[model samples]
Target: MFELLKQPWHWAVSGTLIGLIVPLLLILGNKKFGISSSFRHICASCFPGNVKFFKYEWKKEIWNLFFVGGIIIGAFIATVFLTDPANSIRIAPDTAGILNSYGITDFSSLMPVQLFNWSNLFSIKGLVFFVIGGFLVGFGTRYAGGCTSGHSIMGLANLQKASLIATLFFMAGGFFSTNILIPLIFKYLQ
Candidate 1:
């Protein structure tokens, strides 16, 4: 079971499952689905501020909050408790060699790698990066008015041109970050 979960096929299956979600949401009376919106809905409920931008009747019971929470909890369980291969795609030996040159010798060691190292979750540098990354992600989700899943799936499902553009930009950013930025930073780390 663990080995089965590690295959790229598992990721493909997961992606297919996610691809179904947007259609399901649309069929269910067009729920305004998106992770970014869910975050806003939560903030508005908590703060209940009077600012023009932050104005919303956030007093309603946010079912989406529960849904988002479920997704998060499910992810943790899948990674930690579930026996699986963890969807790790190995780098080529040459690529890994270059990475080692830049200071990331056991690169995969930085992450769960095997999904059992709960201690790595609290390492000093790991904690710093996690907190900062969480903050940036939160801020970006709010600023973008939706997260990747929301925009790419629900928004695009509804034929939103804006969502299409945002998703394209998102892919471009990811490509640049992984191909260009990751190598440059790894160089400095060494």
Candidate 2:
């Protein structure tokens, strides 16, 4: 059972579970499935000051907090218990060669130490990858009114036009970043 858990499952297995969540949440209590709004709930619950945005009755959405908590707990369990020490990332030869060209040969962990370690945190590469990228993601999530899972999964599941638009933009942005922005950053910034 532990060996099975350590092995990568078929994408369809998890995809089906994720797909089921929309109807399950709706069936349970007409609850919307989203992770981004939990941040607002945390702000409201912790700092209920004069911030008009977080002034709502966030207690009504307390279940969302529990849902997010479950995700965190699940991650901890998977990382500490389910992970196989011998298993390493398996990249395609061509992909690995391209990455090697970019001076990112370390494939021992999920993130390459060259780009993700504390020593590189203050460097231009790290700043662009972590700080700038994080800010853009946060800003995009706020501006779009939801994160990728919220808009692409829950919103689209509900047949929302706004969500369809948001998901399209999300795909386009991802393509642009992967094909253009990332290469430029690695080449010029690194």
Candidate 3:
């Protein structure tokens, strides 16, 4: 069982599990599913009197907080225990060549240490990637009324029109950022 946990599962297995979550949540009278809404729930529960946005009955969504907590704990456990140092990240030679062209040679870790290291955090490139990019993600999530998981999974499962539009834009933004913005940033900033 432990060895099985360490190995990568098939995509269909993961996809089926994720797909089951939608109907399960719906049957349980909870339509929403995503990490972003937990922030709103936290704000509503903690600072109800401070903002109108935080004045809702957040207790109804308390399960989401636990779900987020589980995700964090699971990630920590996987990183610390399940990970194999020898087989950490395996990028294809073609993909590695493309990444190398963008000044990212380190494929030893899940993320490029050259880009995500503590020393880089204080650099201009790091500020743009971490700080500015983080701010944009936060703003975009709020603007879109949810994150990719929420819009793409739950909303689409419920057949909501707004979710379809949001998912389309999300795909477009992802494509543009990956193809154009990230390359430009790597070319000039790094």
**Top TM-score prediction, candidate number:** 2
Worst 10 residues of 1 by lDDT: 108-117
Query: What are the per-residue Cα lDDT tens digits for candidate 1 across 8-102?
Result: 45557878888887767667756666666676776676775776655766555376787689889997886675534444556679977875665
User: What's the CA error at residue 104 for candidate 1, in Å?
Assistant: 3.5
Which residue ranges in model 2 land beyond 4 Å of their true spot?
46-51
Q: Which ten residues in a row have the lowest lDDT in candidate 3?
A: 25-34
Better of 2 and 3 by TM-score: 2
What's the lDDT of the predicted structure labeled candidate 2? Answer: 0.87
Alpha-carbon deviation at 63 in model 2, angstroms: 2.2
TM-score of 1: 0.69
Q: What TM-score should be assigned to candidate 2?
A: 0.87
Judging by lDDT against the true structure, name the best candidate. 2
lDDT of 2 by residue, 1-190 (tens): 8799887667898799889988898899998888888877888899878989889989899999999999999988988888786886677898788889789999887778888888878899879988999888877887899987799999998899999999999999999997899888889976
Which lDDT values do the candidates have, in the order given? 0.67, 0.87, 0.84
Candidate 3 deviant stretches above 4 angstroms: 27-31, 45-51
**How far does residue 178 in candidate 3 sit from its true spot (Å)?**
0.9
